[model samples]
Target: MKIMVLSSYAPTLFLFREDMMNAMLENGHQVIAAAPEPEEEWESKFKKRNIKYVSIKGIERTGANPIKDIKGFFSILKAIKREKPDKIIAYQAKTIAYGCIAAKILNVNEIYALMGGLGSIIRNKNKKSLARNILKAEYKIAFKSCNKVFFQNKDDCNEAVGTGLIKNEKIVMINGSGVNLEKFTKKQIPAKPVFLFIGRILKDKGVIEYIKAAETVKERYPEARIQILGSFDTNPTAIKEEYIYKYVNEGLIEYLGSTNDVRPYLEKCQVFVLPSYHEGTSKSMLEAMATGRPIITTDAPGCREPVINEGNGFLVPVSNVEKLAEKMIWMIEHQDKVEEMGRESLKICREKYDVKKVNDVILKTMDLKKVRKNQNVI
Candidate 1:
């Protein structure tokens, strides 16, 4: 089988789907990735793995010129015809919408659309915006054309169903892209309570709330550590760099900056926190669980899935800095439960979200088993 996975961002595929592509390759299927041109380091890594890549720029969010969008659609269709892939899996908003259109023309046997998040298009309160309305229509068409629509959370699945974007049978739920357990294994919980946040610094990701909560926690547990590691995003909702710098300078939180590997920092943390407004299934939360770090996230959709309050960690109201702070304070006051919660976090990941297990479900949903069984080529 030949499979092409497409996304708008380089980091997303490099970080999340690279292992899955390698797994498919090990199983004797050809794999290729289509993404925006990545940095030299990412390009080098792909070359080392012998993964083919096609650079498709200007296909990002807010780059919605109809002319470029039309060109992108046909360009992808041409690529599909040339590669003749048996399946195409797409992530991110624009890629999924266009990939579905191209797959229809190419008559691809299987198309998997990953709704990583409903994103601002649907999550934003303003439903009357022209862009949002257009996006909604595009999603309806994309979902109708997809062989399987993968959702990270129940809310996204339910929303799509309610909007008549997809039939109940077409939706498949998976843990937010599974974490690499071996890569993010258990570590010794820090001697002093440490709370870490890892994700792009976007307003919708609740960076402001996390900052306020950190300040509140410090008032009670002055020795408590709060660290944030992630790059600023170009998304409209991104936090200003100056604000992040101010927080770092004020000792509200230690900004460790972004890194390719987060495991080293996760090892030194007792709690992983993400007070994001929502998520498809937060990959960072999954990694925190795999690394045996207790989690404290919001009670909203995608963010709440990995947490079982009092078992792994706690959940507070989204955007409520005071409540988030109280939860952090509780974690600090009862430091003895850190490791116990960490143990439970790891247990949950191992049982419910092992990468192999989640990837297997994706393969089965694509009907790869039936395809191979009928071919009987092995």
Candidate 2:
């Protein structure tokens, strides 16, 4: 069987869904990955894994130009017509919408979409209602033929149902893109208390709030270290380079620019922090958990799923710098309990967010399991 996985961002397929691709391959299915133009390195990586990578044009990560979106829709339609895959699986908002529409047009059966997050349309306060309404309408149209819509969190699923984009029966909630435990094995907590935040440096991610909390934490505990690791994003809410540099110059944060691998940074920190306003299920938080690091995140949709207050990590109110500071300070002061919390994080990862388990759920739900079984591939 042929299975095509579509995403707006190319790297996301490798970074977050490689296990799923590999699973399909192991099950004797041909896998094709469709996304925006990929980096040469990523292209080589996918080739090494025997997965074909097809570039789709005009799928911008930040903007909403209708003409460009229409062009992207046609690009996907063209790919579907050429490849004629047996199943279509798409993730991210734009890809899911366009891919599903293309699949439906091509008369493809077994169409699936993974709603990673509702994206900025739902969270950006500055967005016009008209734009939101248009997006909602597009989602309704795109998902009309989806055999399954996988949501990373229950909150996102509920919101989709509430908006009438999809019914409750069509929804399948999975733990965020699961962590590879073998790759992100537990590490010893750093001796000097380090708090790390990883994600695109966007306002909605609460980057500013994290910086403020870091400033407050540093004043009380001069020995504590605060680190920020992520790229400056092109999103409208992205933190400006100047602001990041100012914080770095003031010694408030140790700014490590974008990295291809986060395990090294994860190894050096005792706690992971993502005070994001929302999320689909934060892959970073799950990675931190697999590495046995306690987390500090906001109590919002995607951000709150991986944490159990006072268990694996603490959950502060969204955009509350003061509370975020308090939690960071408390984590530092109560160093003795940090290891215990870290253990709990690893336990949760094992029980709920292992990559194999998540992929199994995905494959079975897509009915690929039955196909593989009939082929005697599993």
Candidate 3:
């Protein structure tokens, strides 16, 4: 069987979906990864794993441009025609919308859409209803023939169903792109207190709230460190470079920029924080849990899924800088409990969020194993 996985970002295919892709290949299935403006490094990475990489043109990850999106739709349709895949799995908004439509037109046997998150348009409170309505209609059309739609959290699934974008029968809620426990092993808690945030520096991700919380916490515990790891995004809600530079210049937090491997940063942090407004499932939070770091995230949607309310870590109210700061201070004061919480985090990750187990569930759900004659049971 041939499988085609589509994503807006090339690195995401290798970063988050590597385990799934590898499982498909080990099962004697061919995998072709498609993305727009693919990085050269990702092409080499895919080649090393024996997965074919193809570039899809005119995909802008941020906005909605009809002309560009139409071109992108045709490009994906052409790719589907060329690959003749037995199954098509697409992640994120644009890719899922366009990929599913293309696969349907090509008469692909199975189409899977992975809703990583509702994009900024749907989440943006400031946006007009017209745009959201239009997007919902597009989703409904794209998912009309979808075999199954995977969601990272129940909130997203419920919202899609509520909006009539997809039927209840088509939804499958899985742990947010499960973390590789082997790769992100538990590490000893660092001596110095450190809080880490990883993701695109977007406003909706609660970057402003994080900064405010950091400021409040730092005034009390000057010795404690607040660090951010991620690159600037093209999203309209992205945090400006100047704003980040101001924080760095003021010595409020350390900006480590972006890196391929976040394990090193995760290892050094005592707590992982993401005060996001919403998420399908936060991959960074899962990785932090796997790395034995206590989590400090918002009580909203996907952000709250991994947390067990003072179990693995504390969950503060969304956009509540005071509560966020309070939790950080509490963690600092009771340093001994950090290790215990981190251990629980690692335990939960091993049991519920292991990549291999998650991938197995996905493969079984898609019935991919039965479709391949030489499938390897990895």
Candidate 4:
């Protein structure tokens, strides 16, 4: 079977869905990645794997950009025509919407939209605005058109149904794109307490809360280190450049620009924190768990699933700086518990988020066996 995978961020796909891709390729299916033109570094990595790749223009998030939407739809339509893939797998909102539209036009047999995360546009409670309405409409079109919608967390699945975005029966919940235990192996806890927040340096990711928590913790434990990785995104919720600079200059966080490898940092940290507003199931959180680092994340949707609260880590309410700070401080004060929680984290991740197991379930749902049998018969 020829499978065309579409996403705005190709590196994200490589990071989260690499196992699935390798499994599909190993099973003798042709895999073609259709996404934004990746950076040279990412493109080089893809080329090294000898995977076929194509570039498409698509918005990263929900916005009132019909002009771009129409253009992206047609761009994807052309790719569909050229590839004539037997199946299409779309990830994230924009790519999923455009991919579904193109698949419907090209009459593709199987289509799957991976709702990795709902993002702030769709999930934001305060929605009395034109942009919100436009985003809602986009959801209706994109989700309704897909053959199946794969969600990462129960909250997203329930919300999609409650909002009539997609039927409950149409949704399948999978572990946040399963983590690669091999790539992110267990590590020894560092002596000095280091808390890491690894995600897009967006305001919605609770960057402000992280900074506040870092400051509070630092005041008491002066030697405690906090690091924020991931790039500044152009998303509406992204942290403003000025605010980022201010925080950095004030010595609140040691900012390490985005890097291909995060394991080194993961290994160096005693605890990982992600105060995200929401998530589809944060790959980074799972990576942190796999690396045996206790977590501190929000109690919202995708963000809440990974941490078992005082078992593997603590959970704070979304955007609650005081609560986030308290949780971080708890981990700092009870440093001995860090290793125990890290052990629990590793246990949970290895048990529930084994990449191969999740990918197998996905393949079964897509009827890979039946498809393969039919092809062989032909």
Candidate 5:
């Protein structure tokens, strides 16, 4: 059988779904990965894994643009026509929405999708926009043909049902993409307290709050190291590069830019923080937890999943600078308890967010076992 994986970002396939796809390959399936142009040596990276890379252009990953959407839809349509895959798995907004429709047009019934998050526009709970309405309409049209729709959190699933995109029968909830326990082993906590935040430098990610809190926290506890690790994004809620530079230049924050591997940074920090507006499931947080670092995150959907208030770490209100700083200060004051909480974090990660455990659930749902049985019987 031929299985095609659709992704808006190239790294997502390797970073998130590599285990599942590799499992499929081992089960006697040809795996073809489709996405926009990659950043570095991803084409070679995929080739190294024996996965075919298909580059489809005109995919605007962050925002909604009609010209780009139309072009992306056709590009996917052409790719689907040419590859003629037996099954397709697509994630992210553009890839799921357009890829599903393209597969349907070609009469492919084995279409599956993962809603990582509803997208940045829908993250705002207060305001409603025309873009949200358009997305709802597109989701409604495309989801009718999906065999199963995997979601990282229940809130995202409920939101989809509320929008009438698909019925309850189609929903499958799993932990975020999950973390590689072997890759992110727990290291010794740093001597002095250090707080780390790793994510795209976007306003919706609570970066502004992190900066403000970092400034305040620095004045109170100057020894506490605050660092931000991520690249500037093109999302509408993305902050200008100058803002990040302003804080970094002023010595309020340490900007580490981006890296293919985050384990070293995860090892350096005593605590991890992400005040995101929302998430499908936060892979970065899970990685930190696997590295035996306690968490401080927002109470919103995906952000709130792994935390047990006052247990592993604290959960601050979204966009609350004061509360965010309070938790950071608490961690600094009580260094002895920090390691205990980190142990709990590592425990939780192993129980629930281990990559192998999560991939087993996905493989079972995808009917890999049943397929293998059929093949053997023949």
Candidate 6:
């Protein structure tokens, strides 16, 4: 089968979907990846495995320009025509909205849409906005041709059902883009307390709340290190570098700029935190869990899925700086418990969030061939 995986961001090809695509190739499917402004490195990373990369110049990762999006839809349609894929899996907000429509036009078999997160468009409080309404309608249209819509969390699935975006029968749930356990292997918890947040600097990611919580925690335990690793984003609610830098300058939190690999940071941190307002399921949180780091995230939607509330870690209320700080302080005070919780985190990850396990569910749900263990062609 010729499987085409569409994405708005190229890096996600490596970060989020690498295992799934590799599994498809191992099953003897020809893999084609399409993204906006694809990096040259993509070819070197995938071409040898017979996974082709296609550039869809019309797609933009952020903002709403009808003219541009319309062009993007057409480009996707053209790409579908050219690739003539046997199966199509589209992810990210814009890509799913456009790619599904294109797949439908070409009568592609086994069309799948991954809603990694409801994202700002669906989660935004301002539902009356023209852009939001338009996207909602586009989503309804996209659902028509989608054989299945994979959601990372139950909350997102419920939200879609409530909003009539798609019928409940079409919905499927999977762990947040599964973690590569082998790549993100368990590490010993650092003796020194280091709490880390890994994600885009966006208000939706609760970065501001994380910052505020850091301020509160650090004032009490001045020795505790609060670090953030991620890059600036183009989201409307993105935190300005200046604002994050202000805290960095104040020595409250150490801002380690973005990195292609996060294993080093995950190894260094004893606990991972993400107070995101919502998520389809947070990939960063899962990666940390896979690396044996206890989690400290919100009780909201996807953010809450991985937590067991004192099992692997604590789940504070969303945007609650006080509670978030309280958990941070608790982790700092009970370093012994941190190691125990970290072990639980790794156990849970190995059981439920391993890339192979999660991908097997996806492939079985899509009726695609599932690659057995030790058969990864990548």
My TM-score estimates for the predictions, one after another, are: 0.94, 0.95, 0.96, 0.93, 0.95, 0.96
Worst 10 residues of 2 by lDDT: 369-378
Report how far residue 43 has shifted in candidate 4, in Å.
5.4
Best-to-worst ranking by lDDT = 2, 3, 6, 5, 1, 4
lDDT of each structure?
0.83, 0.87, 0.87, 0.82, 0.85, 0.87
Evaluate model 5: give its TM-score.
0.95
lDDT of 3 at 334: 96
lDDT (Cα, tens digit) per residue for candidate 6, span 55-172:
8878998968889999998988998998798889999889998999888888897799988888777876587788778888888899878999888888888888898889999988
Shift of residue 295 alpha carbon in model 5, Å? 0.2
Which ten contiguous residues of candidate 6 have the minimum total lDDT? 369-378
What TM value does model 2 have? Answer: 0.95
Q: How would you encode candidate 3's per-residue C-alpha lDDT over 1-378 as one tens digit per residue?
A: 889999988877778889889888877788899999655756777887888888887877776789999999999999889878899999878888888988888899999988888876776555467767677777898888798888888887887787678899988878878988779898999989999999999998998999999999999999999999999988878999999999999999999999989999998899999999998889899999998999999998898888988999999998899999999999999999999999999998998888888788788888877444544321
Question: Which parts of model 3 have CA positions greater than 4 angstroms off?
Answer: 38-41, 125-127, 370-378
User: What's the true lDDT of residue 329 in model 3?
Assistant: 95
Residue-level lDDT of model 2, residues 151-188, one tens digit each, is: 99878888888868888888888888898988899999
lDDT of 4 at 294: 94
How many backbone clashes can be found in candidate 4? 1
Per-residue lDDT of candidate 5, residues 228-271 (tens digit)? 99988888888999999998899999999998789889888999
Q: Is candidate 3 or candidate 5 better by lDDT?
A: 3
Positional deviation of residue 216's Cα in model 6 after best superposition, in angstroms: 1.4
- Shift of residue 285 alpha carbon in model 5, Å: 0.3
